[model samples]
Target chain A: MVFICSVATAQLPINWIDPLNEGVLQGRLADNDITGYNRLPDSVKSVVREPVWALGTNNAGVYVNFKTNAKEIQVRYTVSGALDMPHMPKTGVSGLDLYASNNNGEWYWTPGDYRFKDTITYSFGPVKENSHRIYRLYLPLYNTVTWMEIGVSSDATIEFQKEEESPIIIYGTSIAQGGCASRPGLAWSNLLGRALNTPVINLGFSGNGRLEKPIIDLIANTPSRVIILDCLPNLTGVTPENTERIDSLIQAAVYQLRASQPNTPIVLTDHSSGFNKNILDETDNTLYEQTTQAGLASFEKLKQAGVKNLYHLRNADIALDINSTVDYAHPNDFGMVKISDAYQRLIEQFLR
Target chain B: MVFICSVATAQLPINWIDPLNEGVLQGRLADNDITGYNRLPDSVKSVVREPVWALGTNNAGVYVNFKTNAKEIQVRYTVSGALDMPHMPKTGVSGLDLYASNNNGEWYWTPGDYRFKDTITYSFGPVKENSHRIYRLYLPLYNTVTWMEIGVSSDATIEFQKEEESPIIIYGTSIAQGGCASRPGLAWSNLLGRALNTPVINLGFSGNGRLEKPIIDLIANTPSRVIILDCLPNLTGVTPENTERIDSLIQAAVYQLRASQPNTPIVLTDHSSGFNKNILDETDNTLYEQTTQAGLASFEKLKQAGVKNLYHLRNADIALDINSTVDYAHPNDFGMVKISDAYQRLIEQFLR
Candidate 1:
């Protein structure tokens, strides 16, 4: 825990890669929407707000792997716009967040402000400087990446590690997309990726994770070791009036994934109570009850229909106590970590 | 921690107040700024974004005294607008957050979903419902409190408590105003207010806490047990180029406060490092260095000039770990709590 007051900034030669470039991206898609590789569908994209659509474009679940001999490293990138909102901190705007790890499989933010914006460049020596194991760095979670590159000492050996061909994929709400987190790497999905020691895919659509047919098609088509659907909060939307819609959405998504990737285990998660119902608004109470009930009922229906390789996670399992959420709906970093605790364990069973 | 599954909605009499109403407010000023009783000045009000100014109007540092013998209570409030932003959560948007404590001076949110929205109400039982005690509730942080009221069971008693006269006053930036806190009560300022067992004043103007003369005039005029100027982070921006402005702001603020209230101790806090300078963006690093240097230099100037009742807090006092912020600047709940921890200690000195 010794913090040096001042340290010399190392001079080094570096290799850089533009992740949005063809053949360079791995894990998640950068250009899934119709607007020439934007993250959201041009239609559904308009349905959401500006900040959300902008956040959806961030390479949250995406990562880059490069092996370098030199201990010191630097990363640089730019965002489309560093639009500063009064309510949100600048870090969540266009901040180029970084996360790295050695062979030990533990991830840490390079020493500095994990959230930055306007222009992005972070340089730091690895914890194990001498060993040149593969390192992973996640991009922003709440802004669009216009350009990014990696740097290392000129003479150091540098190579990009191959992407994980079969990775665990999580499809859910903003928590899955990394909402209000200080940086991209802190999201539950990304944390699970680091913990499980496997590549993971994040197809989380902020405010639009309603298990639409279009989204399920995309998730089912992806090469995944396991598929997780944690969209109950976004699905029920404070009402059970449309019981058929709730039942059909999950039922259809489950069958679609099974039809495409029959061997890959698909897990459905019930609504995680973001607030204590004991002291909540009537709407929130209704939302909690309807969403969880709908999720459980749909899970039962799927089980009765002999859906193989299917599992269910109850809402109460996570047990996030009071004040864990950033808002009632979004989990803070601690809550996100707690969420990863559940996912890391849930997927392990299928992997074994 | 006794778990009750569900209970019938109790039939009870209710009491409520719409603080925004001209005559109903207590504690906080309804028309401090020249902008027709709003918190912000008429000119500056137009300069800042809508949400920021809207948030300024919220009843922060404001409290309503109420006595109720009812076993259970409910608070209902509606925000001016429920504008949703992606980078921040709904709680930071239009959520109506509430806090209460019994005579022990321990503040707690009235049970369930502490964060609610649009027209939402939070209901909870008192620490002990047998007798009535003075209860205090803090309003929303990032939204305008348009309409609000309180409700109680039929047989219970209820009435408004009086405002404290000579309270602790905090003058600073968005962090002081509760930026990314999931709800109102979690903000460091509110937490400090509760922890100190007294009324506290909040003059935290989002991105606008730059130590302007008008703001200083307001602080000097207010009756306070102690004065805290934590505006360094918001004052210095990213450049120390003019160092004069930073120096002048502090020197002027201290002089004004001393002239107005010579007996009240004034506390100045250095910038809490939200980011590590070693790995921060060049601009952010420059901000850290300049702000710290300017703050220290001014503190020395004040001391040399025989400014009595003056105190300065070092940055190292608050140890905020990485990922503690929603963005690198404004802290999430954990970071806010950490900030409150330091203030709770620092101000305790002046109180004694």
Candidate 2:
């Protein structure tokens, strides 16, 4: 039993690594020709509506996987939007979420001190057990990361992991894009991926997931074992006009997915308003009731029309109570877990 | 059937009511000699430590109750600190959370749009049912409200409810102070109050809840059904010095409370960290492990000395997962609910 200690006069140098160079970028359709750390490629900028194209720039479900034995890890990144919303904190909107897994395969959330400035910085330090450990760093959910660099102690070793080829792809609204979660790691899509130990491509285009033909075509090109369409919440109301539009959109989306990926399991999720909203507020009742009906009717129609492997997840399955959300629309961390648990239960069987 | 409708061109004038004048201001130990919306009386300003006195200005568990039949409801208020935090959003920090109930005694959260400017304004308009209903508006958890006004349609009726005298009083640290709840209404203390249909005094002093003698004297004066001391998180560290200080403080606080309130039940809550921290971070493990041991030892010492009807709640009883918090320390909305559920389960039995 012996111990050796050294004292240095100067600070250790930091080695910055760009994830794109070697790291595994999960929740992306392709690695080539992508302009930045965006969920969508540059080709879609001209094809989709401006709102959808702009939202595609956000790194919602994207995460980078790597292993390092660095005593301290530092993140320097720049974001293109407001750091936070009135209801959602900056940690969920624009902060990096880092998770580490040990040899026993148990994952631990590593918290860090963060500063929001011109160039936001997060310092996760003093790696307690300095052995090489697997790390997954989730990117911001609602903000565009213009650039990012991960810095480690210059003397430490580092390696990048590979992403799973077939991911569970989600095409939905803001909720699916991680609206109002306390942090990026708690987003339902991200939670599902961690629970299943698989990758998940988030194609959620906040307020613009209208089942458009162009976006569906883009989703078709993505390689996925399972696909989820959760766009009804964004297109819900009691008016006859809204009812007609949602019914048609659901029909079109299922047909479009079936045309390209015949064997992929397509899950249609109903609008998840708090289940008791029908008894609480009239405006909410009208919107959610009609949306739920339209979603179920569409799912039944698609299944009867010989669409195999088609499934429907009702709002009741998500089990969101009044306290689950930050605002009525967005799931806070509590709501995020409930939605994630529901998806994990249904989607786990499909993945296996 | 005869149907008649009347139309008026001018906007309905608003009638503003001061909550201090008539509305039930729950969570206050006494309504007299309070300077503003602070939890403590002005007399204690010079007695307690400066940090504890400063945190007392925050309206953590305070809520105003009223019944109104107004067509529109408007809230105009000013907060004296930063509108929000890096990790906790404005909805929890400085925003007013409103909840309504019907005649059938079912509660519903009313959603509204808000703007945070020089003076924050929240509009929860167009009372859909046009019936008089009870409403509870929770004040900000982390900010001081300098002035506030509630306005209703001039034509409608309004009445303030009276607060119960015997509340479940909680004196503790930041988690008790609703450090990072998404909304003030979701704070565990408030949630427990709503669950048990009782008032709850939140004496959470952020980093200053050190079981000081002066603060315990203030707690002893409050008319309470039960008193919960949950200050272990703020007093935690690994050092032998830290353990000795916490042990003595806990012992003194219990003895001090017993001197004044001979019949009241006092609950001592252990520090609540994410249960997995012991296996994850050594620094966290040391602090929590030492704190947990100190708290249990103090609880046992008090009980062995014939402290009757005393209760102790462990961290595991709260059932916080890794996903429960915003930071490693502060509980988010998910964590708040977990803590509330634990308190509700324990406190409900005693209330009966």
* Tens-place lDDT digits, model 2, residues A266-334: 999988773665234556656777888877877888888889999888789997887888767788889
Candidate 1, residue B323: CA error in Å? 2.3
* Residues B234-327 of candidate 2: C-alpha lDDT, one tens digit per residue: 8988778887888899889888888788878899997888356523455666677688888888899989999987998878889677788887
Tell me the spans in candidate 2 whose CA falls farther than 4 Å from its real position.
A1-11, A102-105, A130-132, A277-279, B1-11, B101-106, B125-133, B274-279
lDDT of 2 at A260: 91
How well docked is model 1, in DockQ terms?
0.11
TM-score of the second chain, each candidate in turn, equals 0.83, 0.94
Docking class of 2: medium
Tell me how far candidate 1 lies from the true structure as C-alpha RMSD in angstroms. Answer: 9.8
TM-score per candidate, chains pooled: 0.62, 0.95
Native-to-model Cα distance after best TM-score fit, residue B162 in candidate 2, in Å: 1.4
lDDT of 1 at A199: 79
- List each candidate's DockQ score: 0.11, 0.54
